[model samples]
Target chain A: MQEVLRAHLEQIIPLTDEEFTFIESHFILKKYKKHQFLIQEGMPVKYVYFVVSGLLKLIHTDDTGKQQIISFAMEDWWESDYQAFYTQTEATFSLDCIEDSVVLGLSLESYQTLCEHLPKMEHFFLQKANRGYMALQRRLLSLMTSQAKERYQQLIHQYPTLVQRVPKTLLASYLGVSRETLSRLSFGV
Target chain B: MQEVLRAHLEQIIPLTDEEFTFIESHFILKKYKKHQFLIQEGMPVKYVYFVVSGLLKLIHTDDTGKQQIISFAMEDWWESDYQAFYTQTEATFSLDCIEDSVVLGLSLESYQTLCEHLPKMEHFFLQKANRGYMALQRRLLSLMTSQAKERYQQLIHQYPTLVQRVPKTLLASYLGVSRETLSRLSFGV
Candidate 1:
């Protein structure tokens, strides 16, 4: 499990055995059953989770009780209500396991301490944040310009495994289309 | 103009005069008239601009030649085809001035050297990137869950001055609504 995290970090920055050991000490490992909530809307977000295995979805429920899929995270990916986690505020979104999942969680204090103690970790995180920002920017552009069918095709092209793993209804919600529309589009393709 | 850059940096991390001077030396100041392109689509993105005065719009043109407004950057904000800037690729988006604008431009090499030589600068940039990511996440959620009128309202509430500054058609483009729809929404409000 720890090796999963070490490998993720080392992708952006080289880490020594000692440094990886130091970094690993700050994380607490936990497991959840499918459909269990890692973060509940309106509850304080205590930690950010890095998945070692399995999958999760980040969801926002609007005032009218319509649920929107913000994103999905699988193995080696990080998931959190990041605004809530960073600001120590209550989560406006929820994160739930799509599969039986194991994750390494890091508290805000521990995150700050890790960066303070090891500057390279800060650099590594910065790179991750930049990449995340770029991904979201692309999503925003797609939302602004692409039709539902086009978005579905783009998603499938970008993440064929994700298209296969995610349920059709959830995929529809993520693509901002009706399940009927998604079915038609998928069939048409 | 350099003071604007210094103040922006100091918002996240305080710097010594000598350090500020060193950082300022890496950026070049340039001015552009309204409608001038800071970055052209399919051209190599050379610099990320920090707005000292006036406003700029980042735009994406679809294959059908429909233009979508990605975002607007004004005083104290940084704008670029960041995907291209960081990766050193040709820009898929173009940035153009909405008003005669003065900006300080930082090349990728200077950006990297600044981060490598100053760990605190890296921390500052990490904070900025995290904030940018959070902002984009909120926009994505808005795009997913909100009605066009609701999105228009949210934009007005968040950036009232921006609404007043940007043209109605561009504002409509940013909100993913037609110009007539925006006018109706604005009038209704």
Candidate 2:
């Protein structure tokens, strides 16, 4: 699991053995059962989790109690109620495991201190943030322009494993389509 | 214009006169008339722009040739065909002026060199990217959950001046509403 974390970090920036040791000190590994909440709406977001195994969903529920999936995280991906995490405010979103999961959680203080200790880590996180921003931009554009069928197809093309791993109902929510429509699309009806 | 850029940077990280001078040197100042293209589809994205004054729209045209407004960038905002800018690839989106505009453009090479020269700038950019990502999360969630009218109202509440400044047609396009529907919503019918 620690090797997973080190490998993910090394994908962006090469890490010395000592540097990896220092970075590893900042994170705590946690295991969660399926459907376990890593973050709850209205609680302070304590850590940004990097998934070492299994899958997680970050969701926002509206006033009518309808849940909209904002994003899904799997191996090597990061998840959090990011605005709350960054601002030290109450979370407006919740993160829950879709499967029994293992993740490395890094608190905001450790993130900042580690960045200060290693400017290279700051660069690594910067790249990660930029990539997240880019992915969101693409998603926003897709939502604005593409139909649900196209979105699902694009998703399948991009992450066939994700399509296979996630349940059809959750995939429907993520694509903002009804389960019936998703089933039709999935079955090529 | 340089002072405006300096002030924006200072909002995140304090800087000395010498530091500002070094930072300012990496950017090129340019002015565009309304409807002028800052970036064109299929062209390489040369820089990411920070608006000093006026407004721009980042647009994506679908296969059917209908344009989608990805976002509006007004004073003090940053806008670009970001994926293309970061990856040094041909742009799929076009950035054009909505009003006569002044912007400071930073090329990728300059950005990397600047961050390397001043590690604080790396932190500054990281903060900016995180904020962008957080904002996008809110937007994606809204797109999934909110009606066009609610989205329009949210936009008005967030940026009253922006609502007033932008044309209604573009606003309709941005909100993904028909112009007539937007007019009715605007009139509170």
Clash statistics: count for each candidate: 0, 0
Model 2 lDDT per residue over A1-189, tens place: 899999999998999999999999999999999999999999999999999999999989899999999989999999999999999999999999999999999999999999999999999999999999998998899888999889999899988999999999999999989999999999992
Angstrom error of the Cα, residue B18, model 2: value is 1.2
Over A1-189, each residue of candidate 1 has an lDDT whose tens digit, in order, gives 898898889889999999999999999999999999999999999999999999899999999898999999999889899999999999999999999999999999999999899999999989989999999999999888899999999999988988999999999999989999999999999
DockQ of each: 0.93, 0.94
lDDT of 1 by residue, B9-128 (tens): 999999999999999999999999999999999999999999999999999999999998899999988899999999999999999999999999999999999999988988988998
Query: How many pairs of residues in model 1 come into backbone collision?
Result: 0
Task: List the candidates' TM-scores in order.
Answer: 0.98, 0.98
For model 1, which pairs clash?
A: none
RMSD of 2: 1.1
Q: Pick the candidate with the highest DockQ.
A: 2
